[model samples]
Target: MIRGVRGATTIEKDEPEIIFSEITKLVQEIVTANNIQPEDISSVVISTTTDIKSAFPAKAVRSLEGWQYVPTMCTHEIDVPGALPMCMRVLMHVNTEVHQKDIQHIYLNNAVSLRPDLVK
Candidate 1:
């Protein structure tokens, strides 16, 4: 079976390094907490707020982790009124034996408030 993990985070600014670090933290946290392996991750779908286009945040993963073989992509989040700005969200689909309810999700930074129940 395949399990999914979702995470959300906000960038302090549009700079590439900042976006890179923040996303790296977010992805690593979710992966580690769930005991997920790099090869087990089917793929990751990342979306950033309209305010962020400085760099491909997904590259953050490749540079910081041993997850180079895992497929990843980045896209723009749909612009909506009153939505969080300068934010990046990821939905990770993994090939795992874990059940959906057993998977862990992460929400950090200002995005933490988006799903208080999931923050650890």
Candidate 2:
């Protein structure tokens, strides 16, 4: 079976290091809470709203756990009028037997308001 976890977060500022750190922490939480394994991850996709061009969120975590070879892609989100600025989102396709409801998705910082349904 396969499952997917979705997460989003916002940078408190435009700082590159801060953006990278926030993404690293959030990705770690999402993976741990869902009991995900590096090998179990099929693919990961990330998107940032225009204001967040500092770093690709995917690179922050993938490098930490030697997941550097994972299939990762980053792009820009749809720039709707009045959308959240400096936001980064991730969709992880995982090869797991867990049910969709059992997978714990994450939304951190200002982005936590984006998906009120899932949070700590």
- TM-score, predicted candidate 2 vs. hidden true structure: 0.93
Tell me, by lDDT, which candidate is best. Answer: 1
lDDT by residue (tens digit), candidate 1, 16-115: 9899889998998898888988888899999999999999988888775577888899999889999999999999998888878778899889999888
Q: Score every model by TM-score.
A: 0.94, 0.93
Q: Which stretches of candidate 2 lie over 4 Å from their true place?
A: none
Error of 1 at 35 (Å): 0.3
Query: Residue-pair clashes per candidate, as listed?
Result: 0, 0
State the local distance difference test value for candidate 1: 0.89
